[model samples]
Target: MAEMIEYNCPSCGGKLEFDSTSQKMKCPFCDSIFEIDTIQQYYAEMENSDKSTMNWDTQAGTEWQDGEADKIGVYSCQSCGGDIVADSTTAASKCPYCDNPVVMTGSLSGDLKPDFVIPFKLDKKAAKEALNRYLDGKRLLPKVFRTENHIDEIKGVYVPVWLFDAGVNARMMYKAEKRRMWSDASYSYTETSYYSAVRAGKIDFELVPVDGSTKMDDDIMESIEPYRFNEAVDFQTAYLSGYMADRYDVSAEESIKRANERIKKSTEQIFAQTVKGYSSVVNESSRINLTNGKAKYALYPVWMLNTTWNGNKYTFAMNGQTGKFVGNLPVDKSAAIRWFAGITAVATAVLFGLSFLL
Candidate 1:
């Protein structure tokens, strides 16, 4: 049996949900709002006051057929006593029967606990508006895609990410060339001088995030540039309310390789900037050393939607904190052809007019 925690309003017993707009837990039924710290402290006292009781069930239910229970976890909802079936990586979700948000305590206990969490700043309304703005000006976008997209299915998810901090020392050597040209009445002369430029420096980076979920596409996640880490708060079960969160299936060791790749590229670029005043420069050799490397676990908020068009699936994501939206849309081939033809015709008319003037 899995343990679950559901936050209920102390005043009216209504389910409390974390409200992005207010940055606190608010009860929709009673309209009562409480600070996250207050709610956590209140619940802690309530838990300490309660007596522990355990009831065991010795009877066995219908056995799960072979391979039937793989990658599935079942938890009984405290609010409605309904069994919540979810994926193995799911850490938080809402009860379908009672609509009460639940956090699986065991999933986040011990080594699985996240160090920080950036709560959703923009609400669903903002995400929807951002999607509309994203699709508004795409002239080549298929018309059927807009009408068929399931916009209402958009969900806010807390994606687990690995944040890495490291200090890097880089040394780079570049082969550079300078060119000079001179023209005389009898002949033209060109001179090219080659030189070696070397740059060495130490750079430090903090909170370089890499997505920890295998279900998320790496390219799409990277397109959502950055997340504001200053607004992050200490992770709490209360913040998981009214949203879905995934546990980190990818280990820090695996994620560090990507972090190192990013750090290496950045270090090279920063060091290369110092090699200037050359017509052309080519990197000849480079070395980067990293020290004081560390990794932290955290959850970042994202709004995601999946839609299928013409037997293909399209995914869209919005940064819950920054309201930046990104998605790949299908283009109408016929419309693209017509647009190209129009451009060619206009160019031909302009060339004809120019030729006539000449």
Candidate 2:
């Protein structure tokens, strides 16, 4: 058995769970809500310990082996006493049996500290509204999916990301041609001139983000990017109070390949813009080299929803900072056929009317 601890309500000795709506600990049986700060103070007084170090653990999730059960901690739901095996990076989760919010405080305050974080700007209500707007104006989406999708689960999570900064040295060669045509006194003349274009430049990129969690889909995750790095702030444990967070399992070295690809593409596009005043231009050869490349760990806020319809799972994600939403919806085949038929009938009627007038 792993270490299990329960939080009982102070008023009725009932189990307490964190409420996302009110941002407080609530007792289901008694319907009593308590402030987390007050509860922390009380717990500190009872235990006769330092208040600042309540959730701090200097040596958490340093190493794990195949058979090392000690590395994993089983959290017991305060409401139902149900045990949940939370991995090293999972900061908050709900109990499987009772669905009560459980915060693994010890998991977040360890050696895996992030250098920066972007706090959530939008709440649960905003996420729901964004989902409704996303479903609108999409004719191909199934009608039943719209009505039946009650959103099985919606969570606000801080996804781990690696930000890379690098200086680039790039050189590119291009073949350019200029053509002139003239016709005078029944004689046609054409002149073609060819030139070589070479460009060499150095540029620096700051804070190119790459997803660090293996559970997240790279392509889908990058779809909602451009997280305004200027608004980022230094990491503080207090931000993790009411939201869920994940730690980095993929190291910076492993994520360099993705960062380099984007850097190379951007470099080529920037240099290509300088070539002008030519009828045609073709790239002959190109090379981009990266130097002073470094990576920093950070957390970005996102609101995610997961649902299943007709045995197919749909994932919707919203940028918590910018309120951008993206997801793939199932297309209705029957509705598509009806739409095509309706268009054909309308077109045929208009064509017949025009022929009668002619």
Candidate 3:
């Protein structure tokens, strides 16, 4: 319930704020920009500041942790940032100036040391349009909702997500089998070949994300994906000057567990493909160890749109950072029935014509 506020940029006396498209504190006046700090970006910079591109596989010391300190306090974007005094749990928001969902990077970091992130470049307004366009395709929507549902309800929320990068050393020992068929008879050959392969490599992950909100439902929230993390910028409160933020419900440890699960699933897929042509199954001693484990913090933008139909709340979400759309919509059953009837009548006429020809 916090009101949207605005302030002038100190440098040019022009408007500045968190750019949903860039995830940075940007000054539209002078076009002065600063980057948002993430563990990956920070470490990447330190790891490769002396080199060309930041390489994740490079052996880095544990002292890499010290590089990231409270020295880089969360900046308040006066030009593009603001002092958001709203409660910690406010997840959705709007930019007072542009009236777009301006996700404070904090909302994405969600008070957790981020495991990873993919920040948003798209603003809340564009995100709302994504929702509107998503809604426009649903003809079964109520007329009132189709036309009157305000995009104003769209709140720019920076859903905190975890991105984990680590080197996994996997050792697997298993048995395999193949099946041969001839003359309608099948013969299964169990080849108990004790083969052990070493899988060790560093994984440079861009954005492994999770919702920072406990209020945001997982099934609905997860429908949206593909946040462009490459254009992410440094955290600035100025960018959030206009939007809203949700407090985190998912803990870092929990998110990490989820991320690890994802990594393991992906690993299994890779291994499965590596040992293709197996008919029965591949089973054995399998273990994965995470070396060079690291996490980055980021606030990605999302436009959260909430609507009510027949006194029931329906929700829609747009990736403020990437313009991806997702939500639960109230379908107009009456409209659907009418359309179905029309289609059915048309099909009936076509059938009659075909019968006459026959």
Please tell me which predicted candidate would have the highest TM-score against the true structure.
1
Off by over 4 Å in 1: 54-70, 355-358
lDDT of 1 by residue, 215-303 (tens): 77878778885999999999998998999988888999999989889989988888888888999999999989987466999999999
**lDDT (tens digit, per residue) of candidate 2 on 1-358:** 3322345678997667555456567777898988767776666576576533223233565566776764466666656656687776676666789765555666545557788888777787999999999999989789899999878889888888999999999999999999999999989998999999999999999899999988777776698898988878777544554566777778898998899999999999899889999998898999898984668888888889999998888999999888899998898999899999999999999999999999
Tens digit of per-residue lDDT, candidate 3, span 168-194: 666555566665544435664544444
User: lDDT of all the models against the reference?
Assistant: 0.89, 0.79, 0.57
Q: Give candidates' CA RMSD values in order.
A: 2.0, 6.1, 12.7
TM-score between candidate 3 and the true structure: 0.59
Least lDDT summed over 10 consecutive residues: which range in candidate 1? Answer: 51-60
2 against 3, candidate with superior lDDT: 2
Clashing pairs in 2: none
The alpha-carbon deviation from the true structure for residue 173 of candidate 2, after best TM-score superposition, in angstroms, is 1.0
Worst 10 residues of 2 by lDDT: 50-59
Model 3 misses residue 339 by how many Å? 9.1
